[model samples]
Target: MDRETRYEDSHVSIGSFVLESGEELPHVELAYERVGPSDAPVILVCHALTGNQFTIGEDEPGWWKGLIGKGKYVDTSEFQIVTFNVLGGCNGSTGPCSINPTTGLAYQADFPFISVRDMVHSQKQALEQLGIHHLHAVIGGSLGGMQVLEWGILYPECMDHLVPLAVTPSLSAYGIAYNSISRFAITKDPEWKEGYYNLEKPPAAGLATARMIGMISYRTDDMFQKKFGRKVKGNPGESHTETTYDVESYLHYQGNKLVGRFDANSYLYLLKAMDMHDISRGRDSIAKAAKLIQPNVLAISFKGDLIYPPHELEKMFSLESMAHFYIVDTKFGHDGFLVEFDKWGPLIKQQLKETLKI
Candidate 1:
């Protein structure tokens, strides 16, 4: 738990990892960032679909710095925080963009399909190599949250608590529909060329469009109406067809920003992995799968999230005997879990202080 400031050399190769699809990766390297006291309770912080291992930065603050820092909600001074880039990510982690040992070329479309279970298994393997056999708690939001749930189900004895924010036990049909459209946006792009596009001229337009589609579902219409409304650059009646909505412009900016840094192939792989997220996929019955979860659970949902609405969480957690559920309102919808820390930070802090004593 020596302080890691988003630097390099913090990786472990879990060799010849077999994926859920019965395919094997010759080498699966995981990049991780660990922070806080070496002897303190370890808190595994899982990143979302597009996030990396930098849970807390030194020169620059990390993404969740507001609620997880030296003296933030989770209090790094008292507990260790570890974050790792998920498989199929564009970051330092071995992903679709990584060179395939067989051909010395990027995996691209040739990358084998992976599921959430595969991601959890890979992380567990890496953790074992790093000498982290046990965790005090597992926490994350969105895709990260999905991983947290998987930990509780797959390795119940390895962790004592699970804190999943703004996520459901499984991806909903509505969520899958949105992801389908986004995947279509990327795969159908003329420049995609079956994910083997030239690195210099990747599928920027398609990737951007896919991100735009995601940005739409990540928030609520109520938030949009209040934040954007009918506002336009110039006069509203100047040119009806040409007047661009503020929301439309915002989405365009977000989409373009992701295109600059993220690999399209990685995005496609991660989206499919998310679509395959179900706690009971191989358990045969959801009730049987639920029986596998043994950790004390603290699940918080954003009231405005359209992707994983509060009801989805309620339906799944209702059967948990050791679960604590709370619905917090943040106008940002699904993205609220990343922002508006003030609305949900106290709930998590109280849970940790009251139960985990950290």
Candidate 2:
């Protein structure tokens, strides 16, 4: 919805897409954006949990513009960049907000659970429809990173390089706990009405609280201390009890921002998918799963990230000769991949140039 430069925007019907859980979406619509020449080397950029296909070129600046564009990491002039809203996303894609073709009503809670592999399978279907069989690189961070990890193993021959940034192969206990807290905050809202409530009366309060919890988990103590600390805003001790501290006001702002633009049910589905992500699931062991990855991968971790710490990504060493690990030294925590792009940009450029020759 923001200002973007020249790009192609369209929706593709991918027919019925089946999830790994055996649940099938009778019809799936994927909204996507493409930039650069059709025949150029392809780089598929998977977005984060709440992100959509609008990677760049919006009237409003894109969420990840710092790592993309003319001279950015995935320069559009050199590589055909592709990004798609995932199968269950609400942004121009078939999601809980989309009407069920059969029942003629929004799917809402009726939408089945999806996994990281399912998300990758959906993207693969859309890409195949466009005749894109090979990718110069597959890159993402956070939830998107999980998809990248799945793509490496699921379609080993489809890409030459894999970049999974600030992500864990599976959600850690702490990660799952955080998601659970967020989900509870949303579901407990009486107005949710089991996900069948009217659009105008959405569970804003619950959704905002959920986002507040997520915001807290996304940053480091140092980052928060530097940005907010115990600093009181205005006469908070007298004027407002709720926003007494700068940190409280900041969290409330973030929560409201997300609620204004995102769907609650979609958030639940995506967070559940994250909880279910495990690169080794059904593969017997991590070593066995690592064997399935064909591309040379660069696994990046942020030093102070509590969500997906650097030590967690070291598990990718199971990929052995095919994987190289790097820790991005930053105080920004898990969000460093987004906030400290200046530091990540050069590393990505160097790796992509050397491996994919892009």
- TM-score of candidate 2 against the unseen true structure: 0.95
Backbone clash numbers for all candidates listed: 0, 10
- Candidate 2: residue 238 lDDT (0-100): 77
RMSD from true fold, candidate 2: 2.9
Q: Could you tell me the TM-score of candidate 1? A: 0.94
Off by over 4 Å in 1: 1-9, 235-243, 354-358
**What TM-scores do the predictions have?**
0.94, 0.95
Error of 1 at 187 (Å): 1.4
User: Over the stretch 26-122, how does candidate 1's per-residue lDDT look in tens digits?
Assistant: 9999988888777778889999887888888767788898889877898887888888889888778889888999999998899998888888999
